[model samples]
Target: MIKQVLKNVGITLALFILMINASAQKVTLLQQGRAVSIRGLSVVNDKVAWVSGNKGYVAVTKDAGKTWIWQQVRGFEQSDFRDIEAFSDKEALIMSSGTPALILKTTDGGANWQVKYRNRDTSVFLDAMDFHGKYGCAMSDPSNNHFVLFETTDKGNTWKAREMAKSPLARNDEAAFAASGTCLNIFDNGLIKSNSILMVTGGSVANMIQAHIDEKKWSTQQLPIAQGRSSAGAFSVATNGKNWVVVGGDYQRDTRTDSTACYSNDAGKTWKIAKVTPTFLSCVQHIDSKIYLATGTAGTYLSKDEGLTWTKIDGGSYNVCIKTQHGKLTLLAGGNGKIAMFSMK
Candidate 1:
């Protein structure tokens, strides 16, 4: 009986070890190497996440970020991957700047990334990409005069170019970093100012506003931004499957000064500029209810009352926030060649 009990205990211990290993996968930082700049990050789960940047590098972690393994792509080792996104543990994509847009897709995680599409006919830079199941879209800088929307239905196997209205700012061929989509937003009421040219297209502001994605499909209500004066634009957008938050820039035309952040309870329909202590903001991530994180020139800010207020955590730190399993927050912060972590709790 003693021997049997010992054997049962051993089996139970073994199972527990396996579960822990599965939960905490590895997270490799490509920025670990000298002269590497970590530009973008995306996490599918706690055990699985990806990061990309200059040096044509990409890294993956399956052990909850305890360790990481570096992966390389052909003809991209020297090119910069500005943005990355993961649909699941097994699928991911990376976007880079080039005359003919460069996009990389992987099926077996980051083990092998295949070039799915490239647009050499245009000089526009692909900034961001989004894929929901087999449907996805890519956004590019509008200076190239080429359309910004590229859709793929067969799991990014093939892409179809979409159209957008021509404007003077678009130069008859325009695209913005689809990275944030029109998702780019920032605060205008704060002290941090934006020097970028401010442009507002969507809203109930008469026929002046238009929805390029859909004509009658108003999923979000346009918020009132006081009248006459325009607020800064956003650099990133995050949704908790409920509230939608936008953060980034003042849409300044030339200055790096960005001071604007907004949130909407009903998708994108209406927005209320956050009344937080004024500070420059960048990327926004929603870890959970009442818990939010935004990072940029002012570093990372934690807000418990939505974006109504913000408190700076670290100075001179740029972080891309992600949600992990078990309601944990992952802050991908550190300069090129260095990576650090800060728990949400």
Candidate 2:
């Protein structure tokens, strides 16, 4: 009787271990390098994707994440490309942060680049950029006490700063983060067709700045996420036309799970905190109608109920996440040139 009992216990233990392993999401590293920290990612489709990062590095993969062609933009070897907008495999634009802010465009893939826009102001620092059709916008850190906004009407071929009054004034120590290149987003669904823009900020204050292309006015609202410090606040925002979600946390304390995400159904008039939150999400993207994905230094999370709750699917640090605009492919990029593709089990 004693031997039979011990044998049963051993079988149960093995089964328990297998269950635990199956529950944990698997992360398959597609490529790893130390030369660049990839924060900007644009997955045009399942077969075409582009990434830009430090050391003027830009990579493209025509076969999903299987292989990559890397190149360094000559003469801008020190530039850190934080945001990228790709229209196709042959055309793309990259924006650099910090002094001498720049927007570079490449028409011949990564073979050559042209400086589409340049700002030498010491205070000029671009945080993120988004586009719809031929119109695009890039956001900058506070300059002269107000956040700077630029518009491009020729598909990123040229850019001009909007009127100072068009942008909202920044609060003390409040600014946007270049961590994931997702602080700014533009929505242009044919139904709404209003060209609504959403920008989120952190630091001493956490707020969402909203604007419409048809209106010169911009509005700001405080968020419920963690704030009151430079490392706390909403880092990214995503909308599915009727609902919006914002994700962030005190990145300095990435393990703290409180007040890291929120959602709003009535536009931006009001917000509600998520019942369960992810930690320190640097970027969030609405994958489908009720599907959302967020990633940060702590891990990657998935939400099937429209950001109301989250589950950590992968525990690998990533700076940004983006889905293919025309396909179902989801890709993530992060520090030390890390890149991976997501697969549901």
Best by TM-score: 2
Candidate 2 stretches with Cα past 4 Å from truth are 1-27, 190-193
Q: Which segments of model 1 are wrong by more than 4 Å?
A: 1-33, 143-147, 165-232, 250-258, 324-329
The C-alpha lDDT values of all candidates are 0.55, 0.89
Q: Tens-digit lDDT track for model 2 on 1-345? A: 999999999999999976775464445679886679998999999899999999889999999989999998999999999999998899999999977899999999889899999999988889999998899999998988899999998999989998888777899899998988888989865445477888999999899998787676778999999999988988999888678899999889998999999998877688999998888899998888888889999999988788899988889999999988799788999998999987654
TM-score computed on alpha carbons, candidate 2: 0.91
| Displacement of the residue 239 alpha carbon in candidate 1, Å | 2.5
TM-score of 1: 0.69
Model 1, 106-188: lDDT tens per residue?
Answer: 88867677888878856566766655556666656554443355667777777776644432123221123332222332222
Question: For candidate 2, what is the lDDT?
Answer: 0.89
Which residue pairs in candidate 2 collide?
none
lDDT of 2 at 74: 97
Q: Where is the poorest 10-residue window by lDDT in model 1?
A: 201-210
